[model samples]
Target: MSETARPAGRVDTNMAHPARRYNYWLGGKDNFAADRASGDQVAAVFPTVRRAARENRAFLQRAVGFLAREAGIRQFLDIGTGLPTVDNTHDVAQRIAPQSRIVYVDNDPLVMAHARALLTSSAEGASVYIERDLRDPGSILEAPELHATLDLRQPVGLTLLAILHFVRDFEDPYGVVARLVDAMPSGSYVVMSHGTYDGVPAETVTKLEEANAASGGLSRPRSRTEFTRFLDGLELVEPGVVPIGDWRPSPGTRPPEPADICMYGAVARIP
Candidate 1:
C-alpha cells in the first residue's frame, strides 16, 4: 500500500499533548519545546514517569508478540497509537507473522504527520492509520480504511496502552471499550495498560493530577478493580493484571517495583 497523505491541520505547539509528551519521555526528538516543559513538570512530580513509559512500551512489544505468534492473530486494531516509536504494533507483529495487518488510530496531528512510518508494512502484510479519537468507537469500527485493511470476521489484536486514562469517567470509557470489543470476533484479544494511583502516595497523586490539569489534559488514574472492570467477560492471560514491568519481561530485564511503574497491564481473550 502507498503511504498515507500528511493530514491537514496546524499542530498546536503551545499546548502539550500526551502523545508529544510521551515521545519526549521516550527520548524522541519529535516533540516541541512546550511538550518538553510539560513533561518535565510531570516528571518533577513523578520522577518515575520516564521509566513507566519505557516499561509500558516493553509491555506492548510482549503483548503483540504473544498475540501474533501464540494466538495466531493476523490483524490488529491499535487505538490511541501515539507518535511512531520503535517496535510499533505492526513492526512487532509482522516480524513474527509477515502477513499481519494493522490499523492505527489517533487524533493527534503530529502523529498524523508521522503516520507514514506506521504505514510501512512487510511485503506480505499491510498497515493503515486513521485520524480519529477513542471516544468515537463507531467511527473507528466503521472507517473505510479499517475495513480495507482488516476483516472484522477474523480475530483482531486490540491494543490500548497508556491511553484510556485520558478518557475521563464522564466520557463513559467503559462504553467506548465495550463498543470496540463487541465489534471484534470471538477469538480477538484485548491488550491494555492503564495508569493507577494504587500504591503511589496521595500527595504525589494530587501533584500528578495537577500537572495533567495544567497541561490541559484529563487523566483519571483508576484502581486495580476499576481497571479490571474494563476486562469484564474476557479471559485473562497468565499473571493477570500485574504491573507493566512484570507482564512477561524480556530476558535479562529486571521487573521494576510496583510503586516505580504505577501502571497496570494485562492481555485478555474474548471468549
Candidate 2:
C-alpha cells in the first residue's frame, strides 16, 4: 500500500495538543516544548500522570489483542489514535490475525504524519490513517479509506481509548460515541478507556483540575458512572468497567493501584 498523503492541517507547535502532550508523557521525542511544558504542569499536580498514560496504553494493546484473538474480530476502527507508539492497534491485532484491517483516525496532523511513515501493514493486512476529528464521527466513518479497507457489515472492534475526555461536555461526547456504535454491526465491539476523578480526594481533584486549566485545559475527566454510560445498551465483557490496569491484567504483571491509575476501561459488544 502507498503511504497516505500529508493531511491538510497546519502543525501548530506553539500550542499544546493532547496527542503531543500524551507523546511527551510517554517519553517520546515527537512533542514540542509547549507540549512538554503542559505535560510537566499536569505532572506537577498529578504525579502519576505518566503511569496513567502507560497503563492506558497497555490497556489498549491488551484490548486490541483480545478483540483479534478472542473476540474473532478482524477489523478495527481506532479513533483518537495519538502519535504512533509501541504495540499500536494494528501491531497488536495483526500479530494475532494477520488479515486484520485497521483504520486510524485523529485530528492531529502530526499524528497522521507519523502514522503515514511508521504505521505499515503486513502483506496480509491493511492499515490506513485519516486525519479527522473525533467530534465528527460522520466524516471518519465516511472516509473513502475506511470503506476501502473495512467491511462495516462484519464485526469491527471500535477502540476509543483515552480519547473521549478530550471531547468536552458541550461537544456531546456520548452522541459522538453513539453515532459510531450505531454504524457498526451487531457483533461489533467497543473498547474504551477514560480518565476519571473517581477515587481521588476532593482536594487532589481540585489541584488536578487547576493544573489542567493551567495547561491547555483540553480534557474533561468524567466519572466512572458517566463513562459507563458510553456502553449503555451494550453487553459489557467480564469484570465490567474498572481501573485501566484491572481489566484483564496480563499474568505476572503487577496491576497499578486504582488510586494511582485514575482511569476506567471496558470492552463491550454492540448486541
Candidate 3:
C-alpha cells in the first residue's frame, strides 16, 4: 500500500461525520456514538435508509466495472470516498484492468487513518489516498499525490457517489463539480449518485428533512431538475439519469422502487 503525506487531524467522536454516519448505516463498526445517533434518527423516519446506502454502493461498483471493463478506462478519481468496505473503486477497476490507477479523496481524518486499507492495489496498478475537502477542488487537484498517481493528460473516470448532497448550495456544489470536471480530458467520464426526494411522498420528505435537521445531519436531497444541472454540457450515457438501481442493472435482477431508494444515478462522457 502506498500513501502521500498524511494530513493530521483529530477524530471528533462528539460530532457526527458524514463518512462515519454512512459507515454506521452500512453496518460497519468504525463509527462513534454520535454517528449512530444521527444514523438512527434518520432511519427512524425513513426505514429504508440502510437499503438506500446499499443500493448506492451497488451503483458505485457497477459504474466502476463499466468504466474499467466496457469504457476501457484505466484511471479513476473517487471523491468523497467513505470508510472502505468491499468492492472499492480500485477493487472493481483492477479486477477488469489490473493496470488501472486510482486516487481516492476524502476529508475525514478517520478515513485517512484507514487509507492503508484503500491503498491495497494490484501489483500492476497504483492506488493513493488524499485527505482533502471536496469543496476545495483546487487543493485536491494541486496536491502532489494526485499527479504522481494519475496522468491528467489521459481520460479518467470520476466517481462522486452519494456525496454531493452534503455539499449544500451555500457550499457551491455546482462550482465544485464543474471545477473537477473541467480538469479532466474530453474523453473522460463522470459517475454520480445523489440523494433525492422525487419519488418520495411530500409528507415523508418533510419528515425526513425535519429528522435530518433535528439530528444536526448535513444531508440535502436535491430535485431531479436541480441534480440534472450538474451535467449541463456532458453527454449522458444510455439509461440516463434514473433511480439508483435502474442504471444498467445486472440481467434478470429486480430493482427496488424509486421511492424505496430515493436516489438518482448517472454516468456522462466529458465531451
Candidate 4:
C-alpha cells in the first residue's frame, strides 16, 4: 500500500465532515451522530437531498463506465471522492477494463480511515489514495501517488463529483480547476457535478446554506453560469450542462421529479 493510503491522525467523530455527513445521507454506516444530525436537518428542509446525492452517484458510475469502456480512458483522478460507496470509480472502470488505474483524493480524515481497501489495485492496474485539499489542486497534481499512477501525456478522466461547493468565494475555484486541467493532456475528460440553486426556492436555498453553515459553516453553492464557467474552454458532451439527472440517464433509470435536483452535471473533453 502507498503511504498516502494510511489514515492521518485518529478519526474525529466530533465534527461533521462533509464526506461522512454525505455517507450518512446515503444510508451508509460510516458516519457519526453529529453527521446524522446534520444530514437529517438538511434532509428535513430539502427532502430530495438524498435523491440528489444518489443521482450524483449514479452519474459517476455511468460516467466512469463511459470513460473506460467507450472513451478508452484507463486512468482516473477522482477528486472529492467521499466515503467508499458501492460502484466506486475504480470499481466501475476496472470492472470494464481490468487494467484501469484510479487515484482517489479528499482532505477528510474519515475517508482516510476507509482508504485501506480503496487503494487496492488489480494485478493489471493500480489504485492509490491521497489526502490532499482541493484548494491546492497543484498539490494534488504534484503528489507522489498521483505522479506514479497517472501519465500526464495520456488521457485521464478527472471527476470532481459533488465537491465544487466546498470551495468558497476566495478560493478561485475556476483557476483551481483550470490549473489541474491545464496540466493534463488534450484528450483528458473533466467530469463535474456541483450543487446549485437553480429551480430551488430562494428561502430553501438560504435554509440549506444555513444548515451547511451550522456544521461546515457556509459552503458556497454555485449558479448555472458559475458551474458552466468550469468548462469554459472544453467541449461539452451531448445534453450539455444540465441537471444531474439530465445527463444521459440509462434506460429504465427514471429521472427524479425536479424537486431538489439542485445540482448540475456535465462531462467535457479538455482541448
Candidate 5:
C-alpha cells in the first residue's frame, strides 16, 4: 500500500515521528531526514542511546523467548509496535510455537507501511496489524483485527517496550496499562521496558528533554517507584523490574552499565 493510502492521513515526512526517529536510532533506513535530525540530537546528549536501542531490542527478544518457550504463551498483543526489526514478538513466539497468534498495534503511517515485515508468520501462526493509538486502550482492546487474530479468552503476552515513556502523566499511562491488563485472562503476561532518568547525569537528562521538546516529542522517564505502578496488581516474574540489560541477560552477554542503559524492564503474570 502507498503512504497516501493510509487511513491515519497523509504521511508527513517533514515531521519527526517517534517511531521514525527510533527507526533511525536502530540503524533502519525507513526514516526521513527529520527523523534522523531528531535521533541525532538525542544521541548527542546520550551517546549510549544507540547502544541502548540495540540492548533494548535484545531485551525484547529475551523477554519474548521466555514468554513463548518457558511460559507457553501463544497469543501476543504488541502495542506501540514500531518499525519492524529482527526477532519481533511474533517471530520469537512463532519460532518456539508455530501456532502463535500476534496482533501489532501502532498509529504511525510509516510503521504501517512496513507492516508486511511484521505480518509474516509461520504456516501454523497468524499475524495482523492495527493502526491505532496507545492513548486509547479501549479501542485497541476492541479492535476487530486484534480480536480476529487473538482470542482474548486465552493468555496473551502484552508487550509495551520503550513506548510508555511517550505517554505522559496527563494521559494516565498507569490507567491505560491497567485497562489492557484488566482485559486479559488470569494467566496473561505483561512485558514492559520504560526509559528512566534515574542513573543518568542531571545535565544529560536536561539536554535530552530539551531536544525532545524542540522536536515536538514527549518523553517522561519515571522512577522505579513510579514505574512499578503500571504493574500494580500483577505478579512479577523472577528478578523483578530492573535495568533492561540486567533482566535475564543471556550467557556471555556483557550488560552495559546501569547508568548507560537508562531503562527498566520486567515481565509479570496477571493472576
Candidate 6:
C-alpha cells in the first residue's frame, strides 16, 4: 500500500471485521449481518463474552480518566482502536484535560468510515484519525498524521486493547510492542487488555477460537506469562496484571474473581 493509499473509504460488510464484530458485542449499530452472525456465534458459545466486552470498555474509560486526571498525561496514541463506541479514549481523556491531544490508529475499513465519530474532540483538546496497521510500528510512528497530532517529547499513553492477540508468535508481537514503547519517553504509559484462556473453560476458548478462525480475522489467546511479557520493562500499576473487572474497579461494583472474564487488563508506566 502506498503512503496515501490507506484502507479507508470502502467497507467490507460481507465478512466479519474485528472492529465491527466487537461493536456488535458492545451493542453498537455500526456492525453488519456478518459481524453480528460471527459475534452471536461466539457469544452463544461463551455467554460471558458480552459482559467481558462491556467490562473492557469500562476499564478503558476508567484507565484513560486516570491517565489524564491523575498521571497528567496530555497525549494518547490508541492503536487498533475498534469501532467508535461510547466514551472513547479521547472522550474520557479530554473530558479530564481538555487540552489533551489524541490520535487514533486503526486499519479497519468500518472504523475508517466511522473515523468521523472518533475525531470529534472538545475545543480544549484535539483529535485526529489515522488508518494504519499496528504491525508496521515504524510506519505508524513515522506517519505524518501521528507526528502532527502527538508530541513525542511528552509522556504519551499508548493503548493496545484487544489487539496484540491478532499478531501471532511469528509476527513477534512482543517486538512490535517494544518498538512502540521504546519510541516513547519515560513516564509514558503502556495500557493494554488482552484475551486469554487462563481463566475461562477450555471449551469456551476453543469455540471462540474456532469462530474467529472462520471469520478470517486473527485471534490468539495468550497465557498470563505471555501477557506479562508485554509489560516487561514498565512498572505495573497497583494490583498488577488482573482481569479487566478486577483492575481497580470503582465502589459498589464488586469485581468477580479473574475466572469470570477471559480478558486481562493492566497499566504500566515507563520508568
**C-alpha lDDT score of every prediction, in listed order:** 0.91, 0.92, 0.91, 0.86, 0.88, 0.86
Candidates in order: C-alpha RMSD to true structure: 2.5, 2.2, 2.1, 2.2, 2.4, 1.8
Model 4 off-target regions past 4 Å?
Answer: 1-10
Per-residue accuracy of model 3 over 1-271 as CA lDDT, tens digit each: 2354445567889888999999999999999998998889889878999999999999999988988988999999999989989999999999999999999999898897787665599999999988888998998899888999999999999999999999989999999999999999989999999999997878888888887887675888899999999999999998999998999998899999998899999999999
How do the residues 168-198 of candidate 5 rate in per-residue lDDT, one tens digit apiece?
Answer: 9999998899899989999999999999999
Task: Give the residue spans of candidate 6 off by over 4 A.
Answer: 1-5
On TM-score, the stronger of 3 and 4 is: 3
Of 3 and 5, which scores higher on lDDT?
Answer: 3
Put down candidate 4 lDDT per residue, 94-130, tens digits, no spaces.
Answer: 9999999888998887686587655567899988888
**TM-scores, all models, native as reference:** 0.95, 0.96, 0.96, 0.94, 0.95, 0.94
Clashing pairs in 4: 213-218
- lDDT over C-alpha atoms for residue 157 of model 5: 95
Candidate 2: worst 10 consecutive residues by lDDT? Answer: 1-10
Model 5's lDDT to the true fold? 0.88
Per-residue lDDT over 70-92 for candidate 2, one digit per residue giving the tens place of the 0 to 100 score = 99999999999999999999999
Clash count, one per candidate: 0, 0, 0, 1, 0, 1
**Clash count (model 6, backbone only):** 1
What tens digits encode model 1's per-residue C-alpha lDDT throughout 1-271? Answer: 2234323457889988889989999999999988999999889999989999999999999999999999999999999899988899999999999999999988797797697654589999998888878998887887889999999999999999999998999999999999999999999999999999999998998888888888886578899999999999999999899999889988998899999899999999998
Estimate candidate 4's alpha-carbon lDDT, on a 0 to 1 scale.
0.86
Local error of candidate 1 at residue 66 (angstroms): 0.4
Instruction: Please give the lDDT score for candidate 1.
Output: 0.91
Error of 2 at 9 (Å): 0.7
Model 6 Cα RMSD, 1 decimal: 1.8
